[model samples]
Target: MTDVTLSVPQLHEWELMRAGAYGRALRYELPGDDPHRPSLLVRDTAPGSTLTLLDTEATPIARVRVDGSRTEPEGTWVGGVVEPLREPATPTFPELRPVETGELVAQATLLLGRRHGRLDGTVIVVDTGDAHAVSQTVRGLRHDQVDLRLLPEPAAAHLEGAARTELLVHLASVVFASTVHVIRGEAPAPGDGLVVLFTGLSGSGKSTVARQLTRRLRAETSQRVTLLDGDQVRSMLSSGLGFSRADRELNVRRIGWVASQIAAHGGIAICAPIAPYDSMRQEVRAMAERVGRFILVHVATPLEVCEARDRKGMYAKARAGEIKEFTGISDPYEEPADADIVIGRDDADAETITDRVYRLVMGGPEPDYAI
Candidate 1:
């Protein structure tokens, strides 16, 4: 039998089809000239031939029987599930830490009862962004005959055809259940960890504002506060990295990872970096959000204003072609469209700007300071 490897998303799509979520007449298409496309196998395989489907780890997950009797588009296939060897494996997410084992099992048990009506059969639940270790804990625990499965939340939850029909059936049953017990509880308190990221041009006052904010937070709040200044972090954590685009991105990611760790522990991390690319900032946001709250502060100082304030003559060297990949001069800076707070160069004085950010972080008025 021929073998084909499918990505996680593709595997989910295939599983949906196998579960009759797509009608019998519906066919899947694999376009493009890519050799890995399943269309190649469909064209060559004869009717009734079988193909093995492998996951990213090369583990066999299912088998597909080609129905060559059916005609399809130029690059498409009409395949049916011959057998499903095993359930789709969950994607590995190493960066997130595991939740408490007991808490995870309790939550999984509740979800199983609510969704499946019994705790004996296989039950799939959406992952709660915890690390793989937490999911493994569920496997170690014994819950009578229950088999629990964890699936990540789909990027796009909308479904068509039979899938939608199945969802509607589930919802209707849930609504019309004979005994419905509504459990009420207070909203969860905010997480202890907080990541405040400052992004702007090199000569912008982001570093200065970050330093002041760090001092203020340390003095005012009981939470531990750490400042990750770009230059200081470069000299220590990201030492030996160059100014290339790849290296710069790596440096920013490293800073974000460390900040996320601090946030995970219920501390405050203030980061000041000229994160020129929107993609880099988004990556940082994702990392921080998994563990705690993430606040992005964009210091929107104009490029000309920043150049005028460049006392180090770095901008001059970049304009003279002596330096390559400089952020405002050579490389492009993608301004953030999702900044929680934006401070222009002429917005306000440092104290006023610092006070405004402090209030937002505290969710209310600033506390009085001690002499």
Candidate 2:
């Protein structure tokens, strides 16, 4: 079978990639990032092929159909939003653009041959999904050179974790970079429990849901559960921190750190923090994923609804200019774009929401909750 590869920039993309792996049952070890902030996968879809987005429990949340030419990403989906691919990716990926490889191949061979004392044997350069273009380049480069075999490496969707990394590194080594001093580590053992992180606006019932979920999990399941409420965390773990974005991120990270530790020991870490940024939420997700499973439950109560539920009158104060840097008022609260489970005030009752969360945690069937 030919291998296929796609660069995953987010947690949802990674998850989708894993789900679409050959046989649909293979596993991969997720990487770790800042425990200081909280955090958070995808797949390559062939033209005319459909890809479904699922949660950690393998429950379908949405579906996307690949459209347009194979080289370009264009799709339409039902149920939720999926980010379109961005060209000229990022600073770390300047070489990952969609230029014609005919010129690139000639340039690469000359440079690589010069550096590595002439290329020989079977050197495979993986070409993401532009296999035809890459293959043409390799064939062009190999003209009459029988001893030098430059093959276009196939898609590598079947490769798991370190193996996938190693292959990609090997591909880079053959063309642009070397894999010297690259240390490959073993995949960590899967933790027995999960860390359910509730992130959203203040008065979103994140704390309430987290506490109630903890209670339900303890009563219904044998897994140990721990609640890390935002108010308590701010007062204890982040007493001196102000409401600046950096400080808020740090506070969220502190909570993530503690939650990760708890999850590592096979305990459910239920955290409800007003984690207002996507980056921090992803940071926390990465931290916990390395040690245990991480589930992002977005208590997606709207700004108006949250304000109405605000018992502290913080929203009113913020509107009156008495409070500063208040999220959803003076400051922005970035919503989770790819949350595992999303609950809102109008969605269902507390009991129903808690039950849904419990089902997801236990790997049971997910309700048809529209993202």
Candidate 3:
């Protein structure tokens, strides 16, 4: 039998398999659109072949047998595993803890009944700002627990007045397993800290808009405003990083972490990066929202428009094969479906773009910009 190897990059995939969501079948998607040039696992492996699944660290996670079955929409292969793999000795991810759903529900119900005399009309909100936290909390939950709302930390933090106070008291009481007193005072101003992240192509004017917005915030607002522009950040924060997919992801993550720290300390951070991957953008949003609000601004200037406005001749270099993995030329930019604001090509002028962003940051209604 032929032996094949596959790499699993995400933890959730393994978790799904562990939860028996995939049953005995394994489905793998081929990398590109070309069906003729499939990977070795898809093209060479036939029935009775052995498939070895490896994690990112090159550790063997599971073994499967090829079933020679094809899935829908083309370029997907299916195999069957005789039994589930054993758990790793050292947890692949130490940061994630297995959420005890039953215990959590029991504690929450007991606390609510003790405090309010009943569970009716009571809602338990789980802070799901982290992706791993969300996955862990969600996978173990039963369908009957309708009162539990898994919201992001920022949304849950937006609770005000009596609702917010009740949540805090309940959390404290549950943690301590005893009565706890809460000293209420004036809440902190909502506009104190946040991250405004701008994403688009390299020449999509996001950096310009970010710079202008930075100037506006510094001139008008009392809070500290830090601008983490792409070129400047690459020069300083990510000096030795290359332009490969892994390096680009690491660079964006570094920017996200620093921006999160700034937001945590009651400082606004304006960031402009060509964050092409949706996963990376979601990661940054999650990191920022754990500490403060996060606004994703998608500068939706068309690719041709951006290429035309390129002043540094980078686009030309990319088209001439001088640059590899350049976004919009050799790489892909995944448009965000969760953008809080979309700046279209019509909002061309710097002042108009900056004003739109400024209004959003200063607690104004989000403008109806088409995505």
Per-candidate Cα RMSD to the true structure, in Å, reads 11.5, 17.3, 11.8
* Global Cα lDDT for candidate 1: 0.63
Candidate 1 stretches with Cα past 4 Å from truth are 1-123, 132-147, 152-190, 365-371
List model 3 lDDT by residue over 1-371, tens digit each: 43333322133334333433333344433334422111223322343566665543456666666555553322235445434465533432333222222123333221211122123222333333343433433343423343432311112222446664464455433332244433322322332469989999988889888999999899999899999999999999999999988778778888998998898778999999999988778878877876689999999999998988889999999999999999999999999999998985674687887888899999899988653
* TM-score attained by model 1: 0.59
Tell me the TM-score of model 3. Answer: 0.55
TM-score of each: 0.59, 0.53, 0.55
List, residue by residue over 159-190, the lDDT tens digit for candidate 1: 44555334433321222222222222232244
Residue 124 lDDT (model 2): 35
Ranking by TM-score: 1, 3, 2
lDDT of 2 by residue, 1-371 (tens): 11122322333233223323112322222223311110112222332444454433334443444332223111211112232232222222233322223122322321121122234433433333222334444564466352232322223333456565554444434333333223222333466857889988988888877888898888987878989999999999999999987789779878997898788677999999999888788878877775678889888888988888889889999999998999988999888887888887475778778878878888887667643
